[model samples]
Target: MMEAANCSLRVNRLLLDPKFESYKLSLDPLPCYGVELDTAVAEVKLRDDQYTLDHMRAYGMYNYLHCNPWSPDSVFYVDQLGRVMNINVTLDTALGKPIEVFRFPSDLSSCDRRLCSSIHFTSQDWVTLSDGTGTLYLIHILRNDQSAAGKWELKFNQELGDPFIVLHSVLYTRSEVQIIDALILSIEKDELDVEGSGFHVSLEWISITCSPNDDKYEILKRRNLHGKSVPHYAAIEPDGNSLTIISYKPFRFIADETNQPEEERMEEEEKKGKEVRELFKMTFALPEGAGRAVLSSGSVEVTLAKREVGNMWAEVIAGDTQGEFVADPAQSAAIAERLMHLTSEDLNPNPDCEKPPCNAQELEECDMSLEDSTTLCRFDGNTTKATHVVNLGGNQFLFSLEAAPELMPCFSLRHDVDALMWQPVSSQGDNLWDHAATFNALGYVQASKQDKKFFTCAPNFSYAALCECVRRIFIYRQPTPVSTVLYNRKEGRHVGQVAKQQVASLESSDPILGFQASNERLFVLTTKKLFVIRVNTAG
Candidate 1:
């Protein structure tokens, strides 16, 4: 282990035993799996204060290649005959144990070997298997079944008609036993009909939901997005209420046209093509809780953290790519008509107005005559260019806009009675704050702040801490403030700030990949290693 000065944390380097030094390690539960002496071997060894080997087993011929994310005791691999098998690591019998989970049908016997048999355990209870023929099955593990000890039951299957490929699948679970929802991202072939050869891609989003008391899984929603591009990564909020998708192309939304008459809609549809011309950053606002889910383009990663204000917050601190506008004059005119129709409908019933009410069509014609511009609203200044917008639950939102190349403008939005309200956050000025790191009950370390640190404590006291990511590890310190205020005129006296001492720095060699904090520990994952740091509070 390497040590640094003035850091409060300790570092420990873990090495595998000599016999299993060459094996690749799966850090899920600290297990290592690889070939040894021409035999497949799986072992778990962890050392903190002393060295200890937890479990070791060897398979004579059959290889237990991949580890399952759902459970630590299970591993799977495709057999020679294209059959996917799951092996239990705890089965210590001389014969060893393997169970046949799935096999392709005889009709699909000549399916492509490379893609025919791929299985993923998305959650503790849900597993997805594909037949390489555009069919996917969701398997739910019945743990309480008495007839068969570890039985796997098929819940449902979805067929994404010909020429559609499943790019990513994510399962959201509330606990070890309950799966709340699942999201599947797929790409379908467009005009270019040759099965695998196509430059035009139509992206689709499929959402599946299963209640806690029900055993059936149902498709809640499915939408063929307007924009065509490849998505890089996807994430679901902690509450399982929203999903954010990251793609390589600009995001577009399908306009809501439910209120239009069938004839008018059909006539307008004939004039407008299947795709929309105006391009915007991809973001989705689900009806429930009025949550805004932003799907940004590119490889930039977004970080989510809980706030003390009783809502969840997400911060994205990456560079943005300018989107293109490709609308022709005819397309612009058509869009303008639609926008005018929508605005007229919104003002048809005004309870505050005492004048005679006008019909939607009349109002639309009158409004169109007064203005040449079709756009209903527009933002002009640099502060109006939003980089990130977070849904703070209950129709409340926070937007981080770009003020300068390096400065950010912060504001909050909420509904005040019948009208909407936008208020700027005074605490966040033009200073360079870390948008990726968040504060919670545990603590947060930012390198940009002068004091360099902050932490939350019981009875309402908050302290500050700051650190720099020189290497992978953080060298942090708690600075002495020139003046500390403990009282608020309106809220009365507050809890006093805690004074932290100088300690040794936390050190690592690899680049930090991700960080997560719980009530007691901080888990940091680097490109090459994993570091589990203990959280200690000063009294």
Candidate 2:
């Protein structure tokens, strides 16, 4: 846990709207640091300072509400009438209120009140809404002056699925959404066993993706429940290939005792072998490598491939050098500079060479040419080593090969944790293709010589910003702590190093449903109230 001295936490403001209970909170999009509140019947916005209320409007009773994480200014929800509504905060109320973009059939019943309704904004203008009865509707919001001034138009509504009872749903990206469904089974054992009859839950995953055909969507994949535990949450890797599921709550059904007197059935169920199951959280990965991986060999050459049949393969091309690796761009530049300096020194071994080497101009020309050409630098396996795999947020990686003259860049792939291995491109096989064939097979139809200029030997600036934000929020919890400490998600560290008195006070007040964090601020929502806190951390 973080030490109290290292950071200070104080309540910035209480966002209390007595008219309705706030159940969800998210940050507004870029240029607006305000926070958005979802109260089922209305949407509210609080300014960055937390003292001022920016906007509030009642849409109606909604069974489900979801604010776009990337653009909180846009809110999507499912109304009581089974209609999907979109409220663009940027639009004026006089132009229109919440727009009814799509609606389900009148005969279809409202979603099961027991299960939470699903509404996810997959992108800025695309949304997926679920009525909880296995039906999903995709709505695309469009804006064009030809239609109307200041009026956004909704395109055709595309309906997909016959989903199971959706326990939870998440928009993996603009193109994919994953759904988890529960399958309950009843098992019978010997009559003498008191716990003979109980319920077993199996979970299933349904993935929905936009079809290649414009304006259409389809179920791309379905995974049946095969584990002993139930999955409660899931997140897709940035590459959109791997999935991680958090499982908990191993449960078994007991006799429905509503028919018997409550007082008589309570103790009877416990004594008759109905044991309570404790809740635990465990995470596991699923079907790997859905995205393509790219490896660059410092020159204008690069290889791109995908996993197939548990092996890494690339398209074959003629006269392609095999088993040859090249240095990354940065390393290649460094090598060229050193080689030029040595050649200059060797040609002019006199003290006067310090001022002007006899071959200085020749060396300079060689350096310039090397920048656009490939310098074959032999890699002695003993000296050249793949030292570290640097994770550039978004699943990109830089393979740091020490002692090698060049650097290598590797794109996104499912990391093998067991062996800490990366799939090497096929060196010698009939299927092995040259760089050109590999790129073409991966659908890089437009890839050309100029594309190599886009590859960087160093991490991007956005990655540095992410690291700085994470360093600012230092969240820490004590060993075996009971309460979860709230830290700025983007700024804090993983381990607990600090404790705030306000955290205990907040927990005592109500059960925390969830939280949203920006670089400097955090918004926490409980069952009854919402809190905006300013997180201050030591340098």
Candidate 3:
């Protein structure tokens, strides 16, 4: 159904009250009404509004959220100070105070905002968070209790090798956590530095057990970095589960890193000297439903266990269109047999296909996430002034045009609707990026990165979603959400007709830190409020 653009224009009135136009966000009338403008309009009735987070940082990201294990419609938010809270916006008012959990560390206050990350695993009762120093903390959220030492608000600490080692993309199971970490945070190489820099994935696993008789929790930390073979050419294994990098030069593995005195540790590091690239391997288990699989690393090794192994999957994470999974019928049996044999042994392969080469040379031919913005510029010329590098699909990269803050005020630099652009690049070895042409413009986003990660694109390319720079998120499915919406003076924004795209608006004066769209609902978190809006992005 369509409606009028101005609400003050009554049905009985014959003459137009030209004065009523200024009340509307747009001066012109809409070409279409209701649902067409849903994506753009900001005012929306939601289940919740105010929720407080004390130490949120301006440069911080609290938008990264996860599903609440007990509450399907709600989510958990971990703020910059490492405090976790369960927020349920599915109701007019969440009856419960909503338990908020804090970390044992006395001070996450000094941590750098960039290196902060947290995850509340699905179906798991634990929460893991990371700090700038590469340190990690795994908290049994359910067993929120105090330890013997009054300082740490933990029941017990497992001392996982180094509490300071940073981790990424950790995989979880019933009794264990496969924590994968990167040896190098960012890689930058140039022609002058021929042996170019790269990064390798390493893993460590933690086992936990709980007792019913006493409120006791047991945690086992295993850190073993071992690699039996290194193939100089094996970038990634065929099954797609394991990563094998072959390098001729080999280095000694670090055997022990226990409770050595600080001075002794310093002396050991002094003697061992400059950075040595040890062959390391990190393996990730096949997804949950396949079977029982575990990914282990000191040097890492990931093994997949499947009951029906012959059938292959099209992609790794669903909707990732990087490559097609074309399984060769001929090798299916061999792979299945090998996988079956691996199942019998406890994470041991014939020759552990784990570990990357010693030196992470600029595998100019390698798509290892080891590359940073600099490396991306080296590989793709079109990405020269690109502020961010996002690999949405296989070889396609999406970028937004953003210059210095001073340049933003210039009309030439500002985008009318503010949208992202996509460009496809040749894989591995191609530096012909300058010769590359534009693909197509992504749909408009309401928010200007003002620059932060408040934007994310749907995999299927149906639409792109982002929160505007201020307090509004406009969801548009039309040429634009701005002009297509109706403004009735009486009913406020939605005066004449009902616009229906997934719509949510923050009522708070505080700036939004982060938000995520999942399951037809929008979850937004700001410094002083949390809003869960029931939306319909059903294009």
Candidate 4:
């Protein structure tokens, strides 16, 4: 990791040492330097005499041991020049063979293409990748060597959002199965019949086809007892569909005698068996709907049992009509029926009332008044008038009303002015947006959570004292956590002014680039390089 001075980088690879930490070095005064650790597969950079450090532990950049070696693993193939290699890490790891079994160009047709720079070993099959961009790629690396080909190509498609697959560790099974633990997925070897039945679980999704009579694994099942007890099972199908169901325990149920009396244990075992076979049946349905429906790509419509769910039933429209219903325990069926009735009447109102004349006052004030606007309301009640005067926050104000008398009591700071500011849009026939070579401004912007407005701090001498302002953007590799101060020849120091602020924490030696204040968040080239300590407004 990076420190504040005397730039030094270190890497190491240690498997069984709990006290073992990654290489550490100082990065205080040096511009650039590299150091290697025997336990690590990479080197570190030093800046400003400081260096940042990260672990060589699992999930770190250098640790690529995910999935069985015989199984294809997509890794960030690294080249000599710190670029992402266009090659894929394969399942084939035969001695003396090319570690990269396949590449896009095969013959280096495009040597300019980047070499692997970073890798995230996700599961036996899937991995989420990035080339330092905000965009992440979720790819599945599988062994297609069913034909015993000498080598296989690592191929994948880009996944739009965040990572897809998540990992799972412990697994459950039915008592009937001889083995209590079935490690369905692993990153290591197959039939891992180790001393303990437990195996690391990494849940990943891949396209697979099942043979007609192939063995099928039972995941979730529940058993009903004579009175109240029931057993439930949660399973994942070969195709990735999840199933949860209740089933009755079989007669061969065995009770753990260690925890119960011998005579009672036999009786309890029989009771458990009977409980497994009762009333609860599996009612297959979607686990949950999109929590709240919205108009995204299409109108909000929920289809259940091959029928469309009417909007009125969900309070989307004012009136209700007869439509298919989806039973939900959260909402009342009676309320749903009532809403449907209301929707029909509201949308299909009676045709007799003079075709409802439009309100001239509303039409004149409406933003679309020039068009044929329709009347939305008709007031028939008699009107009353009143007046009130009050002083608020040392300011006296008077207001008149033609409504209820309680309007006076309702006058509180509910609509009080929270903030005030002024900016010159135009001054001296020059627009503030315009700037000359001699004018420079560096302003600090902060967000006010209470008011929800981004406030740009007023420019002080920091902007005024500069000789000339150049609208230029520069990218520098910052490998230090400590803040730096930009000095001027005349002014002693830009007190209270930060040239660069690490919202939360900063690392001294980790190579950081392309960081912008507007889009806050430090980007580390790789997890092996540096693990940034981020700034959180909440804390």
For model 4, how does the per-residue alpha-carbon lDDT over 24-109 read when each residue is reduced to its tens digit?
23232312111121122222222221111211111221222222222222222333333333212221222122144333322221
**C-alpha positional error of residue 464 in candidate 1 after TM-score superposition, expressed in Å:** 30
Q: What is the lDDT of candidate 4?
A: 0.23
Q: What is the TM-score of each candidate against the true structure?
A: 0.34, 0.31, 0.36, 0.18
Question: Candidate 2 on 1-539: residue-level lDDT in tens?
Answer: 01111111111123111222111212322121223333332222222322211011000111133444454334455545556555544322222345655666643443331222465444444555545445555545465533221232333233333322333333444434433212211111223435622222333344655542364555655443322232322322222333323233222112233533233455666655744342222222223442223322222333433322223223134565454343358757977987984576454468553565445466532122211211111111122211111211211121110111111111211111100112112233322111110110111111211211111111111110000111121121111222565454564645332221112123224333333333233333333333334432212
Q: Report, for all candidates in order, the number of backbone clashes.
A: 11, 23, 22, 69
Model 3: per-residue lDDT, tens digit, 346-386?
54445656576645574423233321311121111121112
Give the worst 10-residue stretch by lDDT in candidate 3.
405-414
Count clashing pairs, candidate 2: 23
What is the lDDT, from 0 to 100, of the residue 294 in candidate 1?
Answer: 45
Q: Say what the RMSD of model 1 is.
A: 25.4
Candidate 2 segments exceeding 4 Å error? 1-67, 72-114, 123-125, 141-197, 207-214, 237-241, 248-514, 520-539
- lDDT-best of 1 and 2: 1
Query: Which ranges of candidate 4 are over 4 A from the true structure?
Result: 1-77, 81-94, 101-116, 120-124, 133-135, 146-539
Order of candidates by TM-score, top first?
A: 3, 1, 2, 4
